[model samples]
Target: MWEALVQPFAEFGFMRRALLGCIAISVGATPVGVFLLLRRMSLTGDAMAHAILPGAAVGYLVAGLSLGAMTIGGLLAGIAVALLSGFVTRVTALREDASLAAFYLISLALGVLIVSTRGSNVDLMHVLFGTVLALNNSALILLCSIASITLLALALLFRPLVLECADPQFLRAVSRLSAVTHFTFLALVVLNLVGGFHALGTLMVVGIMIVPAAAARFWAISIGGLILAAVTIAVAASVCGLLVSYHFGLPSGPAIILAAGLAYGLSLTFGPTGSFAARVHPYRHADA
Candidate 1:
């Protein structure tokens, strides 16, 4: 059993790189996902994931698989979509969600068209699905760097973010940091999504951000507990997913996400806080 688990990472450098990259993504993206869940913007993460595709595609067109180009392009595209959506919401009758949806749809179509015009089906698949097992030194560095930045940003934004989550009106009334907080958080989301796409691709990257966070909700009531639980679940899913992929010859990105999905199913069924089992069989309190 130990050999089965340990031998792959022990023998393969790419496996080790993939492991480290996925762990870093879990640590950074999961906390942001917790807040996204609290704010009821889970789908927004998916939208933003797609929003970055055009930028990354542009990068690929310009530089042909250069990590620096794709990363920058993705960041720019994500930030543009986020800011544009916010701007539309502030200035027009449409809500932020609607505006964001429109932008992402357009962005997605544009990205796919551009890539197809310039590249082959294989290149399209690489842009859409990523190649985690082929990560080099630069990709690993990018993942680790984004994770560190995300953790620091989350720490600094925690208090206001919690306030924003609990009561946006109250946060706005009490502090001038509401807009600053919201936009900065969106930027962090974009950053992490950019990092994640390098490993999981735009299609699967949102799973790492959102699924583990949704699972953590079943197990944790407090914000800190939710963040902690999410990080833990994401890391475990990454490891298990990598192992399954290595042994079974599966796609690493989907394998990791499927592991996370399994965790979500289990949490929904058996978690202590508000699971299906808990709903059916309430815990009894002793008479006072």
Candidate 2:
């Protein structure tokens, strides 16, 4: 059974591409996701995930199924949504959360309409459901390139990003780098979302981005521990999902997402981060 399941990688180019893409996305998404969870901006990442559909639709219209065109279009749309959300919060009485709600709904609706106008439901399925087995080398390279850049940027900005997230006021008072930090993270997020969306689709991208990181938080106290755990969980989810997909014919993207979801669920229920599991188990009481 194991040989039968694993045999496809030795023969199919697309399957090979899918496996590598999944690995890249898994490694890339969790670190930023953990930070987003820390900042209470999980919703922002969710918003970005939804925002991709429109970007994808526009990309399809602009250049068919080409990965580069789709990625560029998605990045532009992702940035636009982020900027608009920022603008509405600043200019109006509406709070940041409320502005995000409005933008998320608007972007999703627009994406649906654009995709509908351009192609049939089948094409929409390609954008939304995704075809991991259909991934080409071009798409795989795009995902890897985006992930590499994201990883580099995050490494360089790790200190400031964590500090700024913890206290924007202190950062603002101490360093003029605050503004650059804000948009730079968002820009990186845009790239990550675009790259990841092709694999997980909008609905499931947040899982890839956040679930592993959130899961890892349950077991670790330090940022480094958290990041390492998140990476491990992300990789595990990808490899596990790929195996499930190969053997059982599950959809690779959602299979991986569901795998991530399982990790998050387990962590949430049993993790030390005040999850339901912690409450039920009462580690302190049990130990005492």
Best by the TM-score measure: 1
**How much is 288 displaced in model 1, in angstroms?**
16
Give TM per candidate: 0.98, 0.92
lDDT (10s digit) by residue, model 1, range 1-288: 998999999999999999999999999999999999999999999999999999999999999999999999999999999999999999999999999999999999999999999999988998898898999999999999999999998899889988888898999999998998999999999999999998999999999999999999999999899999999999999999999999999999999999999999999999877899778776632222
> lDDT of all predictions, in order shown?
0.94, 0.82
User: Candidate 2: where are CA atoms >4 Å away?
Assistant: 1-5, 272-288
TM value for model 1: 0.98
Candidate 2 similarity to native, TM-score: 0.92
Number of the predicted model whose lDDT against the real structure is largest: 1
Q: Per-residue CA lDDT of candidate 2, range 120-238, in tens?
A: 99888777767767777777888888778888988998888988898999999999988889899988877888888777777777788888988888878788888888988888888
